[model samples]
Target: MRKLKLQVQMTIDGFVAGPDGQLDWMWIPGERDESIFEKVIDLAESCDTILLGRKMTREFIDHWENVVDNLPDSPEQPLAQLMVNMRKIVFSHTQTAINGRNLEVENGDLTVAVQSLKNEPGRDIMVYGGANFASSLISLNLVDEYYIFRNPVAIGKGLTIFTEQKILKLDSSITYKNGKVIDKYLPV
Candidate 1:
């Protein structure tokens, strides 16, 4: 079976985004690391399909498709192209339609949908979104791996690590000098 991976950039305090949904704190200001960004692009390429929550899907697709054109060419452009080309499955209750190549809208039981996708023949499925969706997947015990880009700064409070009703167990963790940590967990 294909693995389901949640790849997110989070703060030291465990918030994916700030209270106002701002992610400007993620990368260091005036810092450009092409190698690290390239690694992220490579990870994106390894995935066969992407699972997104409603908010993430809409905002990402819109920005990458429209806004990226006006911005100067940089490493972000390649990453945007990868997102456009990959097959996407957006889970949303309010979203009625989706526009793009190989994109699908899913408003049903997340566990069922994810399980069906995992059973299909392909590379690993990647999940990118807020803690709500991640919590849902964790509750279902469906997530196989987690790739967290832990930033240096900490947000006192914002989004949580997981919003699931049950507690999860961490299996292993790896630390990087860039003040990033990758924590892996096993579903009980």
Candidate 2:
């Protein structure tokens, strides 16, 4: 069985994005710390599948594919290529069909679908989606590990992935030079 690891970036105030869905508080292009990207690479290398919600599937796939296609020499090429070629399962109620080579549509019971995936023999799976989707996974006790990257800044009011109270056992915590802290936690 493989673990389902959720990786997300959040503000110091526990918000994933601002109230208006603004992410300006995060590191800008020239200001981004390379450590963050490196950390993501480490996680990406450990995963062979990506779980996404209906809302984020298209944008996430297109962005990575475009970045790798246009910027052949991009610094993020390694992660981009893996993401582009990896198997992606989108949880959507309305979307009955998906159009892509490695894409799959899972409109069945979330728990059943996820459990079936977890029981498969493969590399770990990673979750990438909106707050609601993440919250759903957390609420259902489906996430095996959490990789939370907490930025330095705080947005007082915004979207948070933690809607229900969860007791987490910290597996590890590492802080980068850019004031970003990555905490690995397991459900207690």
Candidate 3:
């Protein structure tokens, strides 16, 4: 079966987003961090498909599409192209149709859909989630690998994906120059 990998950015206090979905806590001042983008490209290179949650689909797709269309000559072009070209499956009940190439909407059992994707012949699948989806996948124990980009700041109260306790074996960890840390973990 293909592995289902997940990448998420979270605060020091372990919240993925503020109560109002504010990401202001994650922004740093005057720091141009291209290394994180490089790391993202590295992870994307290993996966052929991207799985997304309903709430995350629009913003995520729009951002990458903007990068591909507007930043053709930028340093991020390679990663943008990869993101645009990769097959995307958004599991959404409310969003039945969205505009994009290589995109599909799935409103079925999450486990069944994910399992079927895992059984397919492919390199691996990458999942970008907005808290609830990540929580569900974590609760279901469907994630094989996790890449967490941890910011230095902490928000007192917010959304978190860890609905249940998980014992993780740390595979690797790195502290970026921008003060953001990346930790790769595998469930133990």
Q: Lowest-scoring 10 consecutive residues by lDDT in candidate 1?
A: 66-75
**How far out, in Å, is residue 176 in model 1?**
5.3
TM-score of each: 0.85, 0.95, 0.94
lDDT of prediction 2: 0.88
Each model's C-alpha lDDT?
Answer: 0.78, 0.88, 0.90
Encode model 2's per-residue lDDT on 39-83: one tens digit a residue: 898898898999998877777878888877899988879888888
Highest lDDT model number: 3
lDDT of 3 by residue, 128-167 (tens): 7889998999999999999999998888999999977899
Model 1, position 174, has a per-residue lDDT of 64
Evaluated at residue 80, the lDDT of candidate 2 is 89
Look at candidate 2 and tell me the lDDT of residue 147: 93
| lDDT tens digits by residue: candidate 1, 1-188 | 99998888889888898887788888776555565577678778889899988776667788776635666565578888778788989898888688866689998888888989999998989888766777677767888877777788887878765764655577777665565666665555
Rank ordering of all candidates by lDDT, starting from the highest: 3, 2, 1
Model 1, runs deviating above 4 Å: 67-72, 164-178, 183-188
Stretches of candidate 2 off by over 4 Å are: none
Q: After aligning candidate 3 to the native by TM-score, how far in Å is the CA of 61 from where it should be?
A: 1.5
As for TM-score, the candidate ahead, 2 or 3, is 2
Model 3 CA lDDT for position 104: 93
